[model samples]
Target: MGEVNRRRFLERMTALTATAVATPATLGAIANAGSRFPGETRAGSRAAAGRPDELKLPPAGRPQPAELTELTLAEAARLLRDGDVGAVELVEAYLARIGRWDARYQAFNTVVSRDALEAARTADRTRGRAPLTGVPLAIKDNYFTAGVRTTANSFIFEDFVPDFDATSWARLRDAGAILLGKTQMGPLATTAASTPTGERTTANAWAPHHDDVSPGGSSSGSATAVAARMAASSTGTQTGGSITNPSNAQGLTGIKPTMGRVSLHGILPLTYTRDHPGPLARDAVDAALMLQIMAGPDPADPRSLGLPPVPDYLGAVREDAGALTHPERGGAVRIGVLPGFLDEPEPPEDPAPDPDPDIDRIGSSFPRRERTQAAYRREVATVEARRRMLATLEEMGAEIVALDFPTHWEALTSFNFNNVRLPERSEIFLEHLRDDVRKFGVSLAPWINGLLLPAAEYVRGSRARLVLLREVLDEVFARCDLVTQTAPFPFDMVGLPLIGFPIGFETGSTGYPRPIGGMFGAEPYAEHHLLAVIAAYQRATDWHLRRPADPGELRPAEGNGGGPRGGAGGSAGRDRSPGRYDLFDVMERGE
Candidate 1:
């Protein structure tokens, strides 16, 4: 077969693999709708509550135990294993914290109190066993969990529940991990903007500074929950930038394991070619541990290729610490700095406003020149940051070499198009436009429906674009151990780890809704190990340790200069039921 045919064949295989991996719940919804679901439709329960504007901020009070909340997943596991804390106690602590805070922040859509307690009970039964036994976790709503309402933050699947656990969820559960319930996610896990605009726009735990800004989509809830200490760790998925972006925005550590590192079975799909499942946590060690459990092949998922014997991520974490401490052992690590990736070109000085034919057709005009200038300024900032980051690494005794990939700029746009075009527009047509347009006169019907034709065309265009981008990336990765670039601004400002934030500095004003970052991936499987390295760096550094400015507060004592008469010692009343309940239940008549 010719190269084009070969690529087409591979793409088709990937799409088939994706279709095969989706759970029956998701496939059933698609069959009923006559089209695949959009990210918006599968959105978690939080999105079902309302749009972003309707979300009310959680009431402010004294800061909750941010430090305790920020413990790494591994540390939490050790504490549980050592009897320093019981599973039930840990669950209750987080439950109380969520009650005290999540409403304002909208970090979770559903809290499985019964399931959590049962899991905790199971953990207690298995006391003194299982590395992660009894440890609480939050799964992004996109992952399938049997009998749980796994909404993708969309109305289409608002009532859909899966009958089986996603591969990673099953592994974690088997490992004695307790599920705290499904966290919120972007509407269908589409654009990064979805992260901040879902049913309950998840506020950056490090917000006001990071809130208001996009929380990084698709995995927003997962990142926010981990950051806010709602869960010791959480699972997140990425098609383009979901996991890493939210991780960056929330100042947590995230890994986007290479395409097949973890089974994609039982998750909602954006694109089959790029979808990956990984972990988001307070630090690298926790992420690594989760990755170890989640990694490995599954016969159920055709795309699951056997990973070369999985290493002890905790061991890798230890190795990273040793590498940092022993410069002689680390020996001038060669980091390739992608300068072209850094020097994002500003659009022309006198660019036409509303240059896009689509925008012009809509009679909307954008400030083209101002947008160009803004792009230039943002690129300048990105380059400067890249330089500083290199300096920081060099100060730590690493060698930095400048590398260039002129084609990298095109890669981001290409990836973005592929990420959204087909799935997004397909749902928009079927859900919103088709029926309405079909009601028009027969003669006008075709013309009106023609507007929806772009969706299919865009999908085809995206396939071509992906081919080009993938080829370019493959070439760039051939010579570099790792290509380093500034972590995106939205994430950098919040002090999140960048190990996997993509390169480039596209401006939101320049039609990109978020600050794009550079990436370092070589060959098809390079992102896998590169991300591991990024996790390792974070494991060795304090960069991901930064906390939010106002992590919200704990409700004060009633008698001591506080509102409403309550108990002292911050002990919010506890119900000893085997089942867990939130403040909402306490406030409401329901138990």
Candidate 2:
């Protein structure tokens, strides 16, 4: 074992006796018993015990509708701008909701009730400078929030607080956005748990009672917080599918901005090449509003394009850029589509009666299913939804461009996370890990402590990825304003900006509800075009407005006994095909 790995094992030996490996049955039992994890309980179920916040749900000290928490950020923004609601009342409404329902969802790691109230009060007395003024928002725990405990949902830095804000947070603060609290995140912003340190398991809002489903990760809590309406919007960082995957599971609209569009200063790194801090919200316009407020260049982070002047993203959305005449096509858009994106692969011709040959040989009852039939129902729905969306675009004069860049699915799975990305992550984080040990308040999450690789392999892999993605993206982008595709995409490898939102949901024989979303991509700086297309669709559709089943309402519903991957586990991979031509494929074929 490496030096760091040895020390981590030694430090964890004493605590090992107190913890047990979680199994499906134990997890379900723990959730059904009302405490999903230790030190946590459902909404309004507090008692005389741990922290004061755990004691009871407090009143907001103001009059507000219970449904105010359910309002979209766009709706709330209109009221705030039109003088229908004051910043303080809006803040109180959100606080009351958090105090009431957030316990069940367990979306936040820390609730800054007092600080949020003060900020809202200031917005009422001062002149606002930006679009999201007085709009309450949740900060991801990984982002640096001065004076607040910005633990990255990891035990290593449970008490660590930064003296400065990430550029994204600083910009939001300057815009008069109220900070509700730091929402939970994947451990060290790299795993599914917000805090797997002791016994804190942040449950998904869609299926709180069962272990069969997930809200998605590593930005698991951010998407859930917004989907469950605990916050108007929340920031989520994506290295792979962290933003979009959770959005798909929770039925929320999420944006993974082009890399470096939002400065990463003070935020923990997952992959320096792929990490993007973006917003998860109600719809495209709301996401556009956040982009306008949070994006821009910061000299501190050299990766930031420092684009001379940021565009008026909100204004552009309103301008209906998707409807604008393509100079070449004249009042039409060219949209790119990959037909196989969302479809289930056809079974092989003349298939054997027993497809599960391995299972039969091993004497098992059945072959392991990777995903649920309920999820496939949504996938089929998504495929149909994309076709309808395309028809609408064509009706409005969009020319469909069939695309054949088949390498993406391979890129998603084969590229770095725990493999190629680990060495670079370790180089950047080891010092912090050592410091984390000295200033520790909780246990170290295993992945961060155990995974290490040589820097040579990491660098070599990263370069190849950049080259392949850049070429493929250029080939497809040249023919379209925005490229639309289905889930399980590999867009993150090249840091492409994508807007992910649910197309539809369905229930299968299992009786569990499944949600599926689609991705809209544009080359790096073309976020505006992508937003325009999405905004145009959103204006004509209500998909983004759909909400998931409330966590508080999750009961013992009948579900099929098969264990579906359920889009949890933070897994991303491309489908295997002989057709795609990646650099790896070329090396193998000697082309």
Candidate 3:
């Protein structure tokens, strides 16, 4: 092992020993639990010995082309399988929807309708038995697809096309999935979708006319596409909170699987060790199915080397959505709730009011306090909504445990977090920095910060990460089946699995409903547990079923363009403060 790897292992061993001493019973149970590797199927894991030949279809019915766009991935696949809906018809439905709605929502950067139709025609002839066969998906722009314009929404690779598909996309494609197009993303997976000139592109499907509501970042377009029924489902890559934040913002179910769950072979790098690719679906069951197909070891990515087999993620949720809530599978699910997670975090103390940095000048036109207050109110409503949801789960015999985050959570997430990711990001995009830094636009400041970060600080931050990971695994996860109402930082740092699903909606100041999301995180390779909880929560609530109003039918308010082109909702000259989480800022200003 390299020196750094050795040190990390030693630090984890020391922390684990201390953890075992502190809570012998809890540690004993964790120890008794076999391999935590994501590839290993845990005891009672619902996955069968080999790929099952069963068709997991839902109630069969054929909706009109426009209506068919509203069906979840599994539903669409079922329709195609049962012969009630032709694959060509399904593809045509989504293509038509994208043609009408995508122009307004700006969800897709590139829509290959011709290719999708051709794939659909093939599906109709072959009638493939794969779970995702003929299902239309919007892939994040960063994921490389052979012969597709795989722009990371950046000028650097605007014309770059790959010779082979990204492992994640390849897996989905080989499973008979059809790509509708590459969805827009934050340039280099940093912020909201914007042009080389810094104009915003995508809008939240829930309220495309309301500039006040953000679609969420990096994976914003991916989430918007599915939420607006433009695609059956989509893929997203999360380096910080890219997948979870957008999934939360758009009222979709997004799973950021364990760090190495899905191979990142052909995707653009953000934070090498941090980047996680997963699916964004309309609901938990769809998310589970998409994840199952996309996850596993890939020869292209050494990080994805031998671990354990991908567990039966779809079966875990499908067989019994509420199985994790009851002890029949093992112990009744223990959900860890961090106190004050829903409340706004305490802002950093400022002794001397530092002059606002120049980067702060480039942001939205909305007043800072107004936007902050709105986000705060939304969080308050989110807390109440989640409490009610949890109450329902508890009544169903689920256990909700109050747990404190690690002692250094605030410090690690705040100051030290940036140090860990920035250096690597700087290294990855060093050429861009060396050539023309201005091209980075709003993302430039952080890139420069990473460039200037001290080597010693980076090393220290890297070492501290192992300590934090050990604490999360040994301390927090030891007692809970999942962590509820999650924050993305520490969990991202520790490389655990997180599932984001809509809990409810908070009415925005503009009288439009803004999606409020809840999350559940589990130990590495514990996606089965996370999916089980979310699937059950979704089964009990109709929040995931809520779809945004049709953008084409809605008229844009005066001064705000009806499309994503130019509007009051644009992120023009406004506050560019770093988000609540230092890793990736999708929610700080709610854009």
Candidate 4:
């Protein structure tokens, strides 16, 4: 490890040790119980100590009414401007909701109750109801906050409170957004795992009630909190799939801004090159409002230099609705559909029921029969859904054309490799691994080394990947005004806007939980235009507003279990194929 990374790792280890010591015995007892707040009782059941079913349910009743729910940032701003609501009331409402639901969902690590209320009061008093003034927002734990513990979900930094706010945090505060608390994030934001150190793994709001299922990584808590309405919206940082994937799972709208659009200074680094901080909210309008307050160049972050001015993102939403028509309106809306992205070779059948006694013993609990039938049904349903979505878009006046990029497959490889070199991972291992390496086991040593070595390789190859991605993106742009595919898989599952660049296959590798989808983007500062297109689609259709029925209300029909396919594990890739598109036909046409 490099000298700098070695130092960082050591610091983190020291922090982790401190955290271990500081945690009360009671905390450790309940840590695995998946309860975040202490002294809170399970909502519907008596505590059974170690039983998972005894965990609390967040306070009930949708905090935001359907009419008030999914309010765009612009609309909220206008309300604040018009004195429709007070900042204090809004902050109080969100806090009350958090107080009730946060324990069950384990979404936040810290609640800045005093700080948030004070900030809201200041906004109401001074800003006199500006757009974001008094808006309650959650900061991802990685961001620095003065006088608050910014642990980055690592034990090593448990007591290491920063003396300064991250540039982004400071900006949000300045914009009059109240900081509710620090939301949990994956440990060091390295692995895609949802469970970060010191916090429970967040569960998908749409998934059956269980903690083991994937909540879509790194930004898991942020997405979950927003989905469950613990907070109106929250901040998340993405290095690859972090933001978008969680947003997909939680059914929230998220933006992965082009690199350099948001400042990273004061925020913990992952891959400095790839890490992007963005908003996860209920819909596109809310996301746009948050983006307006957060986007800008920061002198503290050298990467943000030479960036152009951020346009009024809210204006783009208006433009999409024909509120601001320009000469470009006469141009046909040409959208490219990359059909090759939908194809995936089936996994070789599970080694024919491993006949060995040992294999049988290990797999005894596996529900083979029911899981198989459920998987088959889900595959059929997913295929039909995608077909309907595409048909619906075409029916809505979108001119769809086949837009193929055979090289798009390279993105998955590139992103996987890029993840290793992230500074956060390297720094953690470099500083902390020497003494603890033996304790973590031989397997982890190689994995840590894999992270380090491949990170070096990724940095070396990034230039090439960027060149290839830019070339492919340019080609698509040349042929059509926009490129559309099944918006990221999680978006449909969670029900949010699909407005970003596509970077991975919609059908993920075998054994993985969910299929991934890529997004489209324009030049650096041009994300606004891309967002506008998404907003246009949303305006033309109510798809983004469709919320799944509450899990408690769902009932199974006569022959079927109303439970999610794959139970929790099976749900991962059960819906891989688009319900609408036929893989065989797309492949045959390509051939």
Candidate 1's TM-score reads 0.65
Measured over all alpha carbons after superposition, the RMSD of each candidate to the real structure, in angstroms, is 17.2, 16.7, 12.2, 17.2
Q: Which runs of model 3 end up more than 4 angstroms from their true locations?
A: 1-60, 319-322, 325-329, 342-373, 555-591
Top-down TM-score ranking: 3, 2, 4, 1
Candidate 4 local Cα displacement, residue 355, angstroms: 15
Alpha carbon deviation, residue 213, candidate 2 (Å): 1.6
lDDT of 1 by residue, 428-487 (tens): 335434445432111122233335546666566556556554544565444444555433
Q: Residue 78 error for model 1, in Å?
A: 1.0
Question: Against the true structure, what is each candidate's TM-score?
Answer: 0.65, 0.75, 0.83, 0.68
Provide the lowest-lDDT 10-residue window in model 2. Answer: 582-591
Q: After superposition, how far is residue 423 of candidate 2 from its true place, in Å?
A: 1.4
Which portions of model 1 show Cα errors greater than 4 Å?
Answer: 1-67, 192-200, 208-211, 306-312, 320-332, 340-384, 406-474, 485-498, 501-523, 526-528, 549-591
In candidate 4, which residue ranges exceed 4 Å CA deviation?
Answer: 1-73, 191-200, 319-330, 341-383, 406-424, 427-429, 435-447, 450-460, 484-523, 547-591
TM-score of 3: 0.83
- Global lDDT of each model? 0.52, 0.60, 0.71, 0.51
Model 3 superposed RMSD (Cα)? 12.2
Clash totals for all models, in order? 24, 3, 5, 32
For candidate 3, write residues 370-391 as lDDT tens digits.
2244445665787788888788
